[model samples]
Target: MPPRPRARTYDPAKTRAAVTAQLEHVRDAVRGLGEEQLAAPTRLGDWTVRELVAHLSMAVGAVGRHLERPAPPAPEVTATGWVAATAALGGDIDDDTRSLAASAAPAELLDRAAARFAELLPQAPGDRLLAARVGAMRLDDFLVTRCVELVVHTDDLAAALGTTLPYDRQALATATRLLADALAAKAPGGSVEVRVPPYAVVQCVEGPRHTRGTPPNVVETAPLTWIRLATGRLDWSEAVEEADVTASGERADLAPHLPLLA
Candidate 1:
């Protein structure tokens, strides 16, 4: 078997700042919601806007909760691995988000979550291990995953409300890079060049390797479009039909390897 591709690295401080900025963006948008808007449905199964908003708090604030617990011994997941590990967790996540949505108003839930996150962030180091829901991971790695949760769900929240929320530059870039790397890990090779400009580029899918110049297979798209595709928010054929993604070469059809996370 071919060796596993090395996961890309992320800076913990930038990740932390991105998470904070994005959460504030979510909080700001949610604060203006009326009951009617909150009841609107999102593309994420049965979750309505309210449930989706509540889930952001649960997702980002998990850091503080983990820090309060006993440290786990060793790392078991990386930012890329977390993407592969999350598909099996849908049911549990749904239950938890529903419970959270029912417990408090979106504004209240997010405010408290944000306050706690800010209070706890400075107390620990990046290498501090936390037993994340997927597996034990360094605080730094886990923070990187928060980029995915915030950026993707923020997109969900916007789609549900028909509004655009601010995308923190670092948060969007980190999530884009993490998911891009996840794609490489999912289908390791060197035949295709997948690029999300101003953020990441990775080669994957086994074939004749491209040592230089134009690769035989190439796929390129905007970062948000790439994130939506990687998370199954956008369909492969549909993206191609609409010209949201450009593909070249037979090996470049990525429909068979997508939505690395549910």
Candidate 2:
């Protein structure tokens, strides 16, 4: 693997708070979902609304499950590493999420997951190492991943339900920053500056570096649009075509480097 980039530092308290707030946002929305709505299709290919919610529970619940295991001697993965590693587990994740969704009502599963996560997360230290499938990762780092999960899936859930869902500000910010930083790590360089105003600004893509004044290449977009592009929910070319993203230089085209977290 490429040399691990310096990982971003996250406030453990803020991360935990963001996770809790976002999970509750999903819980509140799903509590009123009827069978018809629960059976609705989501953008995640075959997963229904029920399966997606179950997967969200699993995403949060994984932390507790790993914490219950013996702690690892050292963290084998950084937060950025976790981003690229997730795609490999797609098959297993799909199987487990489907199984869990079938085993209980969506509301009940979400409640239990929320309670379990709340109980275990508060007791665990930020440096505690988790026995994650991708590899051992720190509690704080893993929690940051959970923010991505909650924010991204909450959007998926909202899209499936054809209604807008409230997003926890901290949760959205953390998720956006993490993915933005991941993109920089994936394409390490100082040739391009990507700005997601108010949330993140990262330099990436290898070429002649800029040291002073304005960068030669700059790409700017909103937080949600950035999230969508990074996660493959939105296409880069389409975003540019629709003027959703502003690109001003030759190296500003990020199409080849997008969907960084597939």
Question: What digit string (tens of lDDT, one per residue) describes model 1 on residues 1-262?
Answer: 5556665778778889999999989998998799999999999998999999889989977989999999998899987889999999999999999999999999999998899999999888999999999999999999999989999999999999998789999999999999999889888889889989989999888888888888889999999999999999999999999999999998999999998887
On TM-score, the leading prediction is: 1
Candidate 2 segments exceeding 4 Å error: 1-6
Local distance difference test scores for all models: 0.92, 0.90
RMSD, one per candidate, in order: 0.9, 1.7
As a whole number from 0 to 100, the lDDT of residue 135 in candidate 1 is 96
